[model samples]
Target chain A: MKTQPLVIAGRTFASRLFTGTGKFSSSALMEEALLASGSELVTVALKRVNVADADDDILRHLGHPQFSLLPNTSGVRTAKEAVFAAQLAREALETNWLKLEIHPDPKYLLPDPVETLRAAEELVKLGFVVLPYVHADPVLCKRLEEAGVAAVMPLGAPIGSNKGLLTREFLEIIIGQSRVPVVVDAGLGAPRTPPPPSKWAPTRCW
Target chain B: MSFRPIFESHPWDDVKASIYAKTGADVERALAAPRRTLDDFRALISPAAAPYLEQMAQLSQQRTRQRFGHTVQLYVPLYLSNECQNICTYCGFSLDNKIARRTLSSVEMLAEAAVLKGWGYEHVLLVTGEANQTVGVDYLEKALRTLRPHFAHLSMEVQPLDQEDYERLIPEGLNTVLVYQETYHQDDYKKHHPKGKKSNFHYRLDTPDRLGRAGIHKMGLGVLIGLEDWRTDCFYAALHLDYLERTYWQTKYSLSFPRLRPAEGMLQPKVEMSDRELVQLICAYRLLSDEVELSLSTRENPTFRDHVVQLGITSLSAGSKTNPGGYAVAPESLEQFEISDERSPAAIAAMLRRQGLEPVWKDWDATLTALAR
Candidate 1:
């Protein structure tokens, strides 16, 4: 049977790959990669965009009808800051959607699950469609799902380490129990290969 | 969400002292038994377990090999920024330290990621400091975006954020967040973190609670060694881990022993844990919870790291840089702390091979992230 589109918080995503506008050699290359990956929901960090300017480089390049922008509160370290960033993103990008990531440690770039949960609870109450970045704990996935999260993004490994899922058992648990959707975030695929575990590492296993 | 009792409150010191007072017979019971409990772990970690160290080693080695197989999950940290507002005494990037501050622009993050990718890494850690205004959530999101396209999976290590923040990041293709309680000793923690948001020891102490409520996928926990009595802090960490595992049954947990290292204007660690003690802790973690991950970093010397892998460590970091763009951008910039085992990824891989263990490089998928969207 063919896979169906993933619907989250009332929005339907035709493609599963959530492309980012950050890494390509150029925006054109990023666009090419995004198209090739067949991703519909694209995530962009609110930091890179010049929200005050109507014309922003990355934002303009990401302007496509088929794609949805997921402005993430990646920089804010507190729930309060994330709430403010989310409000700003909602106003500037004209969308009540956000990706919440709060981490205090800079060395390993680890996420703070405590603050993330707090934010998810409040954001859901605030009417903003929230997606959270967390570990591969299955129960947490369920809780976020219960908290009305669009999806649960659990790491295959540490972010940008390209380490791929070190927490395999946990990821499996999260995947098995997730209700909304289980997106294997961070540390799965190779930057260059992007396909095989040895070459690219992203398994479309979902 | 009804659950079993989290844990019966025991003064962490008492538990440590009890662990310290374990006799060889206790270690024998701990080793000879089919199933072990927290008490058994105490026996195994106690000083009296010394004469039986060789015996403990054999058991730990066998248990580890059996559970983990002959493999090691390898990862590298891409330091994206070093700006901070928190005044953590033992940290390299503590706000009080007058060091150079750097935050990677979207492009710089990619440049740094390219280096990690070149090392055959599939999982990446997007690391940064706690400068809310500059390298805040938006900055992290952008970094993940910049990285998500290139990497299969993404993980981050930065400042803690609210639950909604984590929830939101989930949609953006960001995953696991690891937060270590430098010390569970609230008063000592306050002394270490004298200013900034991090100074709120209660908020930091209650972080896992928030993570549980937010429903994060997995949360890694640890207490920085040298900040407090390792045993007591670890007991609290174990207690917290037990509670977290039970309370947030769905979330996974991992532990790291981040010993205080000499950094730019960083304070000296109060108690230096010997390599022997660290091994005991790792083995104890395994004995206590067979499933929990024990990660060893490059902070330790090559010799010590080489030995501990055989003891219980499931995850290892090979070539790591602690400063932003340390991998590629500003190679000579002030590192968060000096790394001891400066081995290349290949060297670490070779080392694992020599020990009859395979080095695991990739763990997540870009297609999965894409597929989830």
Candidate 2:
């Protein structure tokens, strides 16, 4: 059976497995794991890579044709900084695709809904395909959809906690009502831990 | 009002006494604690923690890698001027020193920028002495405007300016400002800087507050290590950083520890810190906050730089010429201080690679600030 490709902002992604470039001990290991996973859409933190350097290590390994870069504004705290960083990432990485994240608290890395909504509106106006990292709030998801985000990344749990779909109830609500693609970012511990496809099929685990 | 109230609350002598009184048990407790605090930091920097250097280094390496990855950021300093109006006891740029002062013209500044660009450097730190008449706000604005287009990141380490001055310069592509409180000891601070605008310790103490209010993207904080008791000074700096991080929740912060080195007729360090002690301080900082940026400069010898790269440092400066026009125009002029590691950018990059870490030269970009206008 042939599975349908995932489409985001007119770009078709063959693989729905989205990966992030962080936490690996070395670039070689990260590259190996990412290739083995066969993920087509990868996210890189703008703060982590030297965008101006042609030979940035993380970027050097991610130059495969099958992979598309989704630069994230991870360290920014306000909408103004997010907009500025999004434009910079677009200019340097040559991708209008952005993962808008504005988390003021450092302990849990929880996304700020107000700032996320504000930045999403501004970024969409600036011609960016913003996919905001936000909590599993159905109302905020609808609001982001109204603001023209290419997708909405709602948390399964607090980022990196590895608890596995602690927000399943909220996730079901968001997935049922979301007008755009839903990517469940963070907190899936193992490959077998994701809920069955009877819940929602297209919302990939990241 | 400012950091003044917090500064006034902590008596220097008492803080020193408490740090000295920390025991081996306190060190163990601090090491084992899940969430470290200001008191835990004291125990980590105390003499009792000296025996656990290897353990601290391992923990520090783990925390650093977990947060920053296996990478180090490289930046270079561009001396825009050697002019000064301050009389400081430790510096070679004091008003009493007899030397030829030079301020780069807009043309001369760009000439030097071209050299750094050739080296493939996108981050540049613009340095100047405390001469308001020559290298004041207007001069800094012009320098930023001239070099903004050529570099991805521009940081300033000149004399402290007002809140409004920082507000004006941020839109001109100034991303960071580094103001080191030479010493936190008020008496020694007065003695070291007795004859100029820098003599106003309170104004200098409040500079970071002003920068935070101006909404700078980042700021660097530290005390010149040899000025007072290193442990006490560092604890206060950590405390100050704690205050700033909570107060200026929106701004990012970095910390640099610059040991006083020899310069043209410079004063000797009152208390010399061993290389081992410096390593302990670096590890202690990482253990305290996994997020704060730790930077090492060229003042230390090459061997020291090589050894400490794995021990929690995230930023480094290489191929640094501390004198204005030293790179292209005037190589014979006097420098602010003698740089020890004197390696080229490529050589340093090679060194980082040899140690299994990637060297990053352009982690920032100009478009990050372009929209501020």
Residue-level lDDT tens digits of model 1 in B291-367: 67788888999999988888888889989999987888899999998999999999999898787776766544343
Candidate 1 on A50-145: residue-level lDDT in tens? Answer: 665466556777777887889887655566667777777898899887887765443234677787888899898999988888887777778778
Leading candidate by lDDT: 2
Poorest lDDT segment (10 consecutive residues) of candidate 1 chain A: A196-205
Best of the candidates, DockQ: 2
Q: Place model 1 in a CAPRI quality band.
A: incorrect
**lDDT per residue, candidate 2, B180-294, as tens digits?**
9989999999989989999999889999999989988789999998888999999999999989988887677889999999877778999899999999999999899888889
A16 in model 2: Cα distance from truth in Å?
3.8
Interface RMSD of each: 15.5, 3.9
**Candidate 2 off by > 4 Å:** A1-14, A22-33, A45-61, A74-96, A103-110, A122-128, A136-138, A155-181, A186-206
Residue pairs in clash, model 2: none
TM-score per candidate for chain A alone: 0.88, 0.94
Error of 2 at A162 (Å): 7.8
